[model samples]
Target: MHTLSQLRSGKLKGIKRLDLSCGLTTFPEDIFSLADSLEILNLSGNALSSLPDDLPRLKSLKVIFCSDNQFDHLPEVLGRCSNLCMVGFKANQIQTVSAAALPLELRWLILTDNQISHLPAELGQCHALQKLMLAGNQLQSLPETLAACQNLELIRISANQLQALPDWLFSLPKLAWLAFAGNPFCPMPPASPHAPAIHWQDLEVAEQLGEGASGVIYKALWQQENPRAVALKRFKGALTSDGLPQCEMAACIAAGEHPYLIGAIGQVEHPDQHPALLMPLIDGFSNLAGPPSLESCTRDIYAQDQYFSLENTLKIASSIAAAAEHLHAAHILHGDLYAHNILIGPENETRLGDFGAASFYTPEQNLLQNIEVRAFACLLEELLSRTQGSAATLDKLANLQISSAQVTISARPLFSEIKKILSSL
Candidate 1:
């Protein structure tokens, strides 16, 4: 939230990052003054429509965020910035993307909630690309050139006009996280009859539980005959990087009941008709790890000193595997199977949460399940890296990790098989 006055006065010089969001309409020339030190520039929540041609003068810039702006097209000069690797232009009027706008060293690109209908084939030139966010756009199909992105790990194509996903996407060497709900090819499953409707007036909202990209969660008290404490999730009614909150709600309901999954107890519709979910309140739990950092890119960040007992590691992995098997049986893909989404409770209990990236798939699309297997493998590998136990038990877990991460999608063991093998160990 740095102001133009402070920037113009040169008081913010020698900074590695700069954030300006005071209704700016044009690029500030003073920004170039910190070109030697500025590595990140955030101009989100502004009125800017374009950047100056000399934006490349910021030679140290590695990331730039211009979300919630008025840009209609990506700036071509971005391609000339050799050091720039991450670009975020979400929620803009961007309808055109020139091939020259893509940096060759790009690792992450976000163009969500835009009017983009086509993408330049030159995207294939970005061999280092990993994370791509393109939800809430008008894209009907992806360029086949994207298949060359072998390092790509996560992608979001939800809320787009996509007719079908390319088969090659399912075989990417590193592809793991994926979401494609709200597209023509993937219709959400019908509302679950098992999730009974609970009037919002019957619950008393308490302190906030937490918030994520799509919604706000709170602790609530269900004021029924047998009153009980419950968790309430009220969607923000906006398109997230994953997809619509409504789509997530649909996936949560479709997921039904599972021992390791956070199930929806009832559906809630406020007097104004805002949709919400009543869930069983989870007590005394914490996230297994933090989300990926700028350096880790696609991996979760665990505590440096964190170490799990071999028995606890096996239990956590087994619980998650059983839950994943259940989800696949119900024809659902938990697009995000990362450690950060797994909440660890007392006695080594684990519960998988966050349906924001979940999507429905047919049983025939086993490749999708295989893609998730790679994610599960990564989770297992992370746990193994933190555990020390009997060589035999550790060897078994390592074997499962290796088999689950096989480059050949069909070679990966199913969650059911993993669950069984884990139980046997």
Candidate 2:
């Protein structure tokens, strides 16, 4: 498979896979017919207009990634590949998908960054699909048949023309981690104070560190005597009330130097867009990919020893508890403190991220809302449930019980029970 012509010659009869990405500009005719054993094919970053009709001849074909291509229509022969489990057609010119174009065994379908205006009703027949990425498309509405995808966990339908999300969408039992930003269905929260401008040319962006509903974060190198690098969080919207960048900067600055907290570097406005905040970048940290539920964590770490280690789990829980304590001490309630927002860094260190929804307890807003209190209780319950039936967990539970009893109690004592569970951990 040195050249495209050679690959099309049907010489590599036993070849089970083919990757013609990065350099290939055009699809060679008869390329699909040569490799009957081909089970996986990556034709991404190519100039192909359509999939060859002979693609279904490969009996062992299981996965195909045709993203970043010039295809204007969904490949019809794909449905014939009964074993196909995953298909990625992102960043293409696909405008329509016929009802019979989708495969049955497909477990993942990525069609982001396309011109897809409607999804075929037959897509609901792909019962095994567990993940679907349809962001950055022209979808005005989702088909009612999508309710049949009982196994769907993550759905990214952001940046669409949706004026409202279907009621069934919110009813998926496994559905979590939904982001519908840039859609008329969901509106942005009120803004905050604006920050000063910072030049893009002066800052060197390193690797993309994290991403959230609002924006992306990058490790950046700033021009200074020491040339320090910091984590820069760039917000998406422009002309926000006070500006999200300023709000984040103010939160970090007020947070000060705390052992359990990531420190603030500075704040700067984008040269072209909204403002951004710079903070001490944690070297390696990740927001848990799935939901914050205990079941999700158990499923993710069932076979992974490090993830299930008692020492690692205790250390992370303790660190998060300490961080929450610090925030409460500062008269701030971390309105949204879930497993996903709690990042795990090097050496099992834990740090709380995403303070976008945090609420400051000042004279203006003295009491936390019922919803906020309930959310905190739920978070504490989840944390405690993860470390059930342990001595250290018992101790943490006792501490939470005392703390909740002493502090202002809202809703029910069940809320205190959740706090007790956290303290016991």
Candidate 3:
């Protein structure tokens, strides 16, 4: 949030980071004054449409964000920044992406909420790439060259015009997290009769519980024959990185009942036509970890002091495995299978929530299910990293992690097999 006045007065000289959002329509030349120190620059929420040709003068710059701007294309000068690896231009009108605009050291790239319909084949040259966010775009297809990016771990291609899923995407060894719900291949499920619809008037909304990219949840009272406390979720109805909120609710309903799942009890009939869901209130529960940070890119962040006993970690892992098994059995893909989406109770009781990235698939689509196995493996690795102690159970868990992350997708064990092994441990 640095002001133009401070920058103009040279008060921000030698700073390692700079943020200017005062309706900037052009690159501030003064920024180059801190080239020796600046590492991160954020010009989001501005009117900028381009950058100077010599943006590479900032030798120390490593990360840059120009989101919520008026750029029609990513600046080619950005590619010249030798150290820049992370680039974000979310919520812009960018449609063209030049081969020269992508940096060689690129690791994380975010182009969410853009009008991009195509990507350059040179994107495959980013050997260090890890995370990619291209949701809410007009892309009809992705370049086949992207298959060369073996380091890619997380990708968001939901809410696009893709007609089919790329077969090569499922072969990426490191790919774990994926979201592709609101596309031609995958769509919101048809209405289900199993989930009873509760009218809006029957819900007495209380305090908001929390919110995510797709919707907001609140504590409420179901005003029925015997009023009972419940949780209500109201969809935002906008395109998110994971896809549309309706798809999330549809998948949640289709998921049905499972002990480890935060299954929807009923659908909400809002008078104003707002999409919502009702479920039993979860008492005494909290997230297992925080979402990833800028540096971590796609990994969850656990508390510094957080440590789990081998037994408890195994218990938590088993619960999530069972939940995933049930989801796969119902032809649902929990695109997001991270610990951050899991709520933990006092006795290590885990309830997997947040179906915002869930998508429906047919039985023949082993690619979707097997890709999720990599995600499950990632979760197991995270938990095993935090658990301390030595036992036969620990060795078995380690072996399971390796088997689940096998390079050959077919070699990876299914969630059911993982669940059985964990239960035995």
Candidate 4:
């Protein structure tokens, strides 16, 4: 841990990685030239307004953490870093990204909590890019060029000024996880499902996992025979929408005994007449919506020593697909499917949870009438969000050959298959 004053002379040649977060106000000149062999550098918690122009000279540099700085613009020299893959510039004053300033081999680029209002179209040239975060910016639009990135998996643009999402954004093939909360273009609709209620005195609540449109989930220690840990989902009376309780109950029962599905332990009715569900607690899991702040996503991803791996994402997708197939086979429809509803368990096991909007269908029912088009559109949006930027994967996920007007057919078969099973029943 070196300070700005100590780094003035560039005497730390032996150090492969350096951190100058203590009382630093500016970056020393020729810092990168001196540290030719540096692989990682941390200059967070500083007052620097901009980076040195010759920063790309550090050919061995791979990772850079410059969060909490005062940078209003990204350094033009960043494009020269051929070996750089990860760059964190969260909590800065940046307002835009120039197309020419992006590195070609960059895999992960985070610029959360900045003032960015637009993205350059040339960013599409970064074919090797995988994850790009621009949360907490002033962005009202996105570049259409992002469709060129074939390997891109995650693109977070939450809490911005976007009023309408571009049509091409939904066409990315490999794009998987997305969060656009607090955006006027895709506001959290008033159509949220109802949540069951739980009294404070009935169960001992531990840590709060998160809150959703329907209810709050808590890691609780139930006072049972063995005193086991479980996830307690409690609903707020005011937030309860029509048919939510019955839908949730049906989903819990229909999910049944699938390994990838979270087992419903039991249900408890409170004095207030609200119902809550109890299930085994799965650790190290987080919702895909992430945090409301884009800076939070950048900080989490840049902390590579602590974040989830790409392999974990694949496991989650596989498990969710399996669970959805099971529901389809049982003549049940998971009315909602997104990252927030999926959980990652021990040994990277993906478990599907939150069945608040699930429903059962019969052969006589029309698929178009039975499934809410708005809800189905939301699910398709979620799936398309994941496949964005990868033409091949997008084609596979959306099956573009089916035509945009008939995209609903992808989900129609699931219900059609279920209807056939119910006919025999």
What local distance difference test score does each model get? 0.91, 0.63, 0.89, 0.60
Model 3 C-alpha lDDT per residue in residues 1-425, reported as the tens digit of each score: 89988998999989998989999999999899898999999999999999999899999999999998999999999999999999999889999999999999999999999999999999999999999999889999999999999999888898899998898897799888888888998866779887876989887899999998778899999988899999998887666667777788888888998899998887788878888889779999999999988788889999999889998898899899999999998899998999899999999999999888888887778667778998888888999989987777788899999999989888788888888888887
Between candidates 3 and 4, name the one with more favorable lDDT. 3
How many residue pairs clash per model?
0, 11, 0, 14
Model 3: pairs clashing at backbone N, Cα or C within 3 Å: none
Q: By TM-score, is 1 or 3 better?
A: 1
Residue 278, candidate 3: C-alpha displacement in angstroms: 3.4
Cα error, candidate 3, residue 128 (Å): 1.2
What TM-score does prediction 2 earn? 0.65
Q: Write the per-residue lDDT of candidate 4 for residues 64-140, one digit (tens) a residue.
A: 88888888888767888888877888778997678666887788888877889888888888887777777668898
What TM-score does candidate 4 get on C-alpha atoms?
0.55
Instruction: Give lDDT for model 1.
Output: 0.91
Candidate 4 weakest lDDT stretch, 10 residues: 295-304
lDDT by residue (45-95, candidate 2, tens digit) is: 888777767677777888788987898978888988888888888778999
Question: What are the per-residue Cα lDDT tens digits for candidate 1 across 124-176?
Answer: 88999999999999999998899899999999999999988778796687888
Q: What is the lDDT of residue 224 in candidate 4?
A: 51
Task: State how far residue 94 of model 3 sits from its true place (Å).
Answer: 1.4
**Poorly placed runs, candidate 2 (over 4 Å):** 1-15, 22-26, 33-36, 194-196, 201-228, 232-277, 284-308, 315-343, 352-420
lDDT of 4 at 136: 69
TM-score of 3: 0.94
